[model samples]
Target: MAYKYSIGHLTYTFNDLKTLLARATPFRSGDALAGVAATTYQEHVAAQIALADVHLDVFLREALVPYEQDEVTRLIIDSHDAAAFKPIGHFTVGQFRDWLLSDACDTAVLKSLANGITPEMAAAVSKLMRNQELIAAAKKCEVLTSFRNTIGLSGRLSTRLQPNHPTDDPAGISASIIDGILYGSGDAVIGINPAGDSPANTRRLLEMIDNFRRQFAIPTQSCVLCHVTTTLDLIEKHAPVDLTFQSIAGTQSANASFGISLSLLEEAYQATLSLNRGTIGNNVMYFETGQGSALSANAHYGIDQQTCETRAYAVARKFNPLLVNSVVGFIGPEYLYNGKQIIRAALEDHFCAKLLGLPMGMDVCYTNHAEADQDDMDTLITLLGVSGCTFIMGVPGADDVMLNYQSTSFHDALYLRRTLGLRPAPEFEAWLVQQGIMDRQGNQLPDAGTYTRLLGGIGQ
Candidate 1:
């Protein structure tokens, strides 16, 4: 169907829902590259105005991707809870935005609405919201998940201790992990991005991290961010698999580009569940998604990057993942060209995922080739902190030798925790205090030498 809006002597028309969404998206390079972005600022605003009047029910009827061709669309349609949507079912996209920012949409209310709010609905309302509105609405939604430790509790911000090495060297990775733990990071999980995808190498990395976690008796889980299939094989081999990891996208075709399918992911989830690795809870999946992943694979089907990214959260939500993050700027300048665009994308990703009741976090990062720097990261991290983000990455020195990107560092986590008075996961915090690494007030104790004994045989 066609949609149009008029401004005095000027009129703008969108050919379809996909075109309306694409033109309404905040300016980004990927949309332009795909030849879907609006050609002028006026046209973009007009599209937004038209989109604001779209009723929430329209999305349920006209999917951007055909339901017959896409399993993702099928999953979304089949799982929707019509009863849960009754209260807000009459709202238009703009009215939904108003309701989200209103006092009526408290934590409990948003939690109750999660199953009813589709990802497309979330994305639509987000387009009509500003940065602070995005943060304000998301702040009201609390999504807590657990494994060996709990995450997403109020007054807490978790960090993934990412000790990535270019060669997957055990010593180098061990050193990074030690640095992260002492600095009050790693409450989310100690996850590593291996240099190779071979099953043997992936198994070795998982076993090494598992051993380190066990040796310290740290109240945290460990993961080697390998392909889901490789992790499944390792689980079969009885390697200590804490979380099954995968990079997923919005569309089935995009996921296929990464060598995954819904069925394959379901298989991995069931396989990992059999291990019963968690003492606290059994949320065993860790998923990483980013904007432009679908477009990068030529599979977005003309939807805007932000909407496609939001759709990926539906996939994460189905798995009940322990951790789900958007590596916001890691795809580089082609998708999110600069700091401004990257920051907006991160905020939108967080807000949409939270609305859908996913435990949303962000990898506040950028590539050197992109027009961004640490100052941009600092701005984003501060915003996410106040927005009640579940976790962030803790790479040593904010640089990943393996992935060759600039991410938040162990020190960055310390800065945010100190600035915002946030603590790590309760269980991890207790371990930190017991080991003399941190005080009850979330401050790092200045006695580095006292914790050297805890390193034991690591990095040897």
Candidate 2:
């Protein structure tokens, strides 16, 4: 079999794909396919397969996948894996063709096939889908995995207490966390990215979070965002570690930038699971990823940023992370360019990650140099809310005092809950009512004396 290939047009011979199609039951030239010939349809499917293979290949290396520049009407493919994603090898060309040509292809049945296929197949078929179509597929996905009811499930969004500080001071960190809690955030987990990567700093952060948990009886988990090795070290030292944290990338070299590998991540997963430190259960991993991290680390192989980002989610899924957030706009403008690009990338990341069977969230933010604003975040938050996003970053006043950037703030969490009629996780909501910040019916109360004292203590 002769095979042809191209870079400009990005074509591949796909002889195997052709053979796969030829062996499938022939499609009668009926009204379903209309005038589409069997051989022609075979070539079309083969071309799509080839394209997806090439696209995923590039995505694996470059950490970015470019959409076709020319305007084209795309098919709206759905993902079926409501609970979890199935491997791509489970389906054959015949099943894919049948779903692609079906009249009722827009429903859950086809969407399952769309998501159940391998990343390569999904990438290929996704080329035929519009952005809105992708979002629709994600909406049908319902992931219920959670530690202390932080993530998974639908109708509720969660928030992480990113209480990072310049000096890794316990007081500063606790103050930030207290503020987040006072504003009705941090139901997701009290996860922190420490200023220093040393085990001492990591241990101090973990101990602070644990102390606060004991002091306030906050029903949540904790993690210090450091290398998996550093976290493992802290775990060995008997530092309170609720969740193991790591920054994962799509490719080997990029992941190596943080000195991580698939084996190492698995080791961390096993080590954390052995701790049994979770308030809810033993799913104790928290991973953070961004679209440009691979490229920044000089690890991208010309793959598109979105694909690279999704590949990172594959790593996260391997460990069943309690929380996996794509810090979308936090990586800056070099990869995504501006707010328009950021919004598209944010939705694309959420849609792809969710379909891949990982609990997904967006850190709806942008660096100072990026072309974005709070209103841009507002747009993204609303979209993610409707799409059933797992959670969002909740800092103080949309600004990470330690990180020196603006992101979705605790106030934004309230806006999303009030506007979308979404509530916090069940345990967090109950905590709110107990503190008199909200009623049992989920209404905000006018007078909450604890809130006043909290504000006075924080001097806000």
Candidate 3:
């Protein structure tokens, strides 16, 4: 169906829901590159205005990517809860945005509405929201998940100690891990992205981290960001696997590009469950997504990148993941052109994922080529911290040697925690205080001897 709205003397017509959504999206380079972006600023605003009057139920009836062609679309349509959607069934997109910002949408109400809200609905409303509105609405919805430690707790911010090494050297990776732990990071998980995907090398990396975790009796999890099939092989070999990791995308074809299927993911989830590695809780999946993945893989099927990115959350939520993050700026300038675009995409991803009931985190990062810097990252991290993000990356000095990008440093996590009065996960916080790395008041203790002891204890 064609949707039309007038701006001054011009009448803008969107031929379909997908076109409407693409045109209404805030200016990002990926859509422009894909030839789906609005051609002019007036057309963009007109599309937004036309979209606001679209009834919430219109999304339920229309699948942006046809239900027959995509499994992701099928999953979304099949899993929707009509009964839960009944309360706000009558609201238009604009009214839904208003309802999200109103006092009526508390945490409990948001939780009840999770099953009812489709990814498209979440994406649609997000396009109409400002940055602060996205933050405010997301702050009210709490998504808690756990493996060895609880994440997404109120007043708690967690960090993924990403100790990635270019050569997959155990010594260098171990040093980064030690650095992160002393800074009160790694409560989310000490995940490594190995240089190679060899199963033997993956096993070595996993065993190395697991041994260190056990030696210190750390209350956290360990993951080597390898393929799901390799991790599944390691699980069969009884390697110490705490969480199954995968880089997922929104469309079936896009995930196929990553060599993963819904059934394969389910199989991995079940295989990891058989080990029973978690102590606190059993949410055992970790997923990473980015905006331009589908378009990059040539599988977006004409939908905008942001909406396709939001659909990936449906895939994540189905697994009850411990950590699900959007590596927002990692896709570079093509998807998110600059610091402003990166920041907007990060906030939108967090809000849409949280609303869909996933424990959302952000890899507030950018490639060297992107028009962004640590200053932009600082702004993004502080905003996410205030929005109650589940976690952020804690790389060494805001740089990933293996991934070749600028991410949040361990000190950046500390800055967010200290500035916003947020603490680490409860279990990991206790361990930090017990080790004398931090004080009872959540301040890092300035003790050189304590640091010396931690460094000395690394190998033993």
> What are the lDDT scores of the predictions, listed in order?
0.93, 0.66, 0.93
How many backbone clashes does every candidate have? 0, 17, 0
- Ten contiguous residues with the weakest lDDT in model 1: 451-460
In terms of lDDT, the poorest run of 10 residues in model 3 is 451-460
Candidate numbers, best TM-score first, in rank order: 1, 3, 2
Across 1-460, the per-residue lDDT of candidate 3 in tens digits comes to 9999987788999999999999999999999999999999999999999999999999989898889988999999998999989988999999999999999889999999998999999999999999999999999989988888889999999999999999999889989998888889999999999999999999999998888888778899999999999999999898889999999999999999999999999999999988888888999999999999999999999999999999999999889999999999999898899999999999999999999999999999999899998889989998999999999999999999999999999999989998999999999999999888999778888777767776666666
The TM-score of candidate 1 is: 0.99
TM-score of each model, in listed order = 0.99, 0.77, 0.98
Runs with alpha carbons beyond 4 Å of true place in candidate 1: 448-450
Model 2 compared with the native: what TM-score?
0.77
Q: Candidate 2 residues 29-68, lDDT tens each?
A: 1111222222555455545444433422222222122223
Q: Which runs in model 2 stand beyond 4 Å of their true positions?
A: 1-116, 446-448, 452-460
Which scores higher on TM-score, 2 or 3? 3
Listed per candidate, the RMSD to the true structure in angstroms reads 0.9, 10.1, 1.1
Q: Residues 1-460, candidate 1, lDDT per residue (tens digit)?
A: 9999999988898999989999999999999999899999999999999999999999999999999999899989999999999899999999999999998779999999999999999999999999999989888889999999999998899999999999998888888888888898899999999999899998888888887778778999999898888888888889889999999999999999999999999999999888898999999999999999999999999999999999999999899999999999999899999999999999999999999999999999999999999999999999999999999999999999999999999999989999999899999999999989999988888775745775674643
